[model samples]
Target: MVTERLPAKISEKSEEKKIAPASPIGIFDSGVGGLTVLAEIMRQLPNEDVIYIADSARVPYGGRPPEEIIKINQELIPYLIDQGVKLIIMACGTSSSIAYPVLKDKYKVHIIGLIEPGVRAALSATRSGTIGVIATAGTIHSQAYQKTLQSMKKTGLPAGREIKIAAEACPLFVPLIEGGFIETEETRKVAKEYLKPLLKEEIDTLILGCTHYPHLVKVLNALTGGKVVLVDPAEEAVAEAKGLLQKAGTMKGKTFPPRYEYLVTGSVAQFQDVGSRLLGKLITHARQARLPTPERSDGGQVHLPLK
Candidate 1:
């Protein structure tokens, strides 16, 4: 059996060296989309603290330029780091694509993105050679999924085989989810139209490349007729985070599920309303936060408003 080596510069660490038990695992997305990843991480790594930030003020980074996305990420990420987070999870697919290479090597803590894990899950689940990916406009336009799939094909994994990758941008997905329309007929119609190509292509597996898409899981499932497998990238991302934390010995003994902290850059009430719909649970409060200005080249900073 061949063993895959951990990426260079990442290694085992002693858990006792940590300064505080309350250190959080910082997660950020363009808006409430990240809650999907937060849900999975809370489920899988029950003992850690999660600090989730929703940049609702600048929601839907899709269709924006990569440089703009990078600026947003640079600002959001550094703020999370300043909050003393042990690890940073880039839950936004667009930001992950634009900033991961530039930011990952610079951060002292571990950085995990949604793309590679999503690709891995898609590759693993596909019995047929073709895979379908549905994401935001920015993510699809970035071609991150295609690039990852191509890299996976080149890497020669065990039982190596080439896989065909297809991607589509579902621009309406986030709006539908945030508008509390996931269960509505309108959402179903959109899902059907957006998914038609993949269905026609006879793709056996589909990657739900956008974090917000998971909130519409049932709608998508219904449209796909339970035949095509849908892969939630956030779920796979959390699994990867658990593995990394475990291997690094950062996992504390399981006592109880981690407490979740939600922060939003825009309306708190909207976050609660939309977050409750996405999370399938009521969110009483979302602490206010100020994201950095994109103009700042130093990766703008974030400030939490006094409660």
Candidate 2:
């Protein structure tokens, strides 16, 4: 699961001291939902440049087939690579669950996903040895959380104790959050319904599996009575990335603050609007970029046209 921060094939000249290793870290999400992850990375790694691409044109990957999401990422990733990103963050839960392994093995650059960090944090936060995961339908269907917890339990849990993992798919949460209904009472009602199962389980820790789920933290927290701890993967993921980059000697934070660049497949205005809401501040220039289309003639390969 470990990936190099940069490709060895990258010109040694590019690795020289004349250029800092602080190139942009690329992040991709199915849609505006990923801005939450992007914001976390910005807050945690202020010295590193960031590039976020929102695939709003095909927003919800949650219900898409794994192969389809893989196809989407195969096209999306190389564009980011060409942007000179030092690392790639699969901010979308669907992509992380299904596509990350293939991309991580194929790409020489470091690739991090959102799911594992959340799972790890949930495991750590749970004193009752029971963890609840709430995610998009696709993520839940993928059984990523279930599989992860099972593997960890087999290897890491004490011989007598079992780690119980409960997962629910809150499909409505994504649309509600992305549609700017985060603060509505409707959202509260929906959150209560969706979270009641976990509340009954009395699980001590909950993982906000979808990047969009964090947007409803207030509603979710109220439903849990502030007792159950909520784990935001974005936070954990950035922390992991910080440690990884530092250990790799690839971070440059002793000088100026890191710059950030944002790219989106949808209109710049739309991304800016949602991004600002997610970041809780103004989002500066975000250049518009189109996602590549698949060319069947090329064996389901993505063909990028001139930007």
Candidate 3:
């Protein structure tokens, strides 16, 4: 998939500049997990303003139907646009897999997804030729990671070796982490069961395909015996965003105020609570915002909502 980075939409006034570096980069995810991506952006692109939206009211997008994932994004995109985001990041794997294709071509603003970055990172890191992917059912079913790897393998890598991939849908991981189940026996048990097939595949590298999976690292490492490398797409995704901004000469670069904005479609209290934990700091402000209920292209309303 092509991850395009463009200038935010400009006012139609002919005299107006086409680009604005001061516009915040927008990021949206099903819940707190995308904070992993946001944390990396803060660390790597400190100068740029960032706005994050947590669709926490309907948090777990994993098992939902593809159309429903796109439906939720219908609510997300316009909110970010109203926030004056120059670029939007689909930090949720489920949305990236299902909604991205729908939005990338349709939206005028730049949109980037988490899948290709994770795939590329895993490809670059794996030496044993075997890689395992753990993600939401929607992501796995969509085969975004699988397709990425397959495309790379089809052309062959510099090493000229075939790559092996094992994809598993850890549908429960997102909810467990959202519920604060990390580092517990409950988590470990779940990890073992979910990772069993991949372990048997003898994969040397694992892609933490869901952003939420990063917090479950301790359990994942224990389950994988710490020998398998874990690829977190957060870093790679941010790296790509940074590079794009650099090429645009859009780095905020000490000239602007710290404009880290946070919004949610869920309870502000819960959003702040889980987001603060993932972000490793006190998230002082989070406001709830209502989104439009999605409708069909034919002008009918979409009635599905998943948690």
Candidate 4:
């Protein structure tokens, strides 16, 4: 058996001390998409304080360059850490695929992303070795899903079952959903078109690679004819997050209302409105903020207003 060695820095943290039990959990997505994950986290860990950031100004990271996605994550994670969060969740699929590897090494606190958990869930649910992944273009192009599944197969488990992956980049799905088209005929049509190939490949499990993608769960479930197990990363990821909080002694022992904070580099009112509708919470406030200007040389910061 081969054992993977932890980096010296990570070992130092565990050896030195665990995160403060009461510290808030920080979570960020390119935009409102992460609220899906946030909703799940809240459901499972209601008493834990949470600070969520929606980088709505830079919404829809599906087709962005890898460097741009990582740069944005670089800004978001550090800001969350500066707010004294004990843990961070990369709630965007594109960021999970492209940015997590680069940013995880730079941070001291535990950073969790959607990919590995999504991969594990897909693996566990699949009776046949074929898996279907539907995510953003950036995520699919990064090949994160395929790589993780194949790596697991190499671990010599499941003896004769070989994992095969079929990934599709559904670039327009996010826009469709964010535009309030979920459960609409337009959404159904687009989703069916996006899912056709995977169904054709006889996938027994479909991984909803994007956090935003889960908002279309009913649409996807119906389209897949209820024959396929829909593996949602948020569900699996939050389960692991619960264990981590417990290990760090951060799991709330008694039920108490915990503070929930929201921030965004976009329209505050808009984020609050849409956030409230999607998250099942009255999001009364969202602070307008800025990421360091993307073009450092020019200092031309992009401030996008959420629609």
Which residue runs of candidate 2 sit more than 4 Å off their true CA positions? 1-20, 154-159, 293-307
| 182-218 per-residue lDDT for model 2 (tens digits) | 8899999998898888878878889888888888888
Error of 4 at 106 (Å): 1.7
TM-score, ranked from best to worst: 3, 4, 2, 1
RMSD of each: 8.7, 6.4, 6.4, 7.9
Give the TM-score of each candidate.
0.85, 0.86, 0.87, 0.87
Model 2 pairs whose backbones collide: 47-258
lDDT of each: 0.76, 0.75, 0.79, 0.79
Per-residue lDDT of candidate 1, residues 5-55 (tens digit): 112122223122342445779999878888888888767877898888888
Q: Name every residue pair that clashes in candidate 3.
A: none
Global lDDT of model 4: 0.79
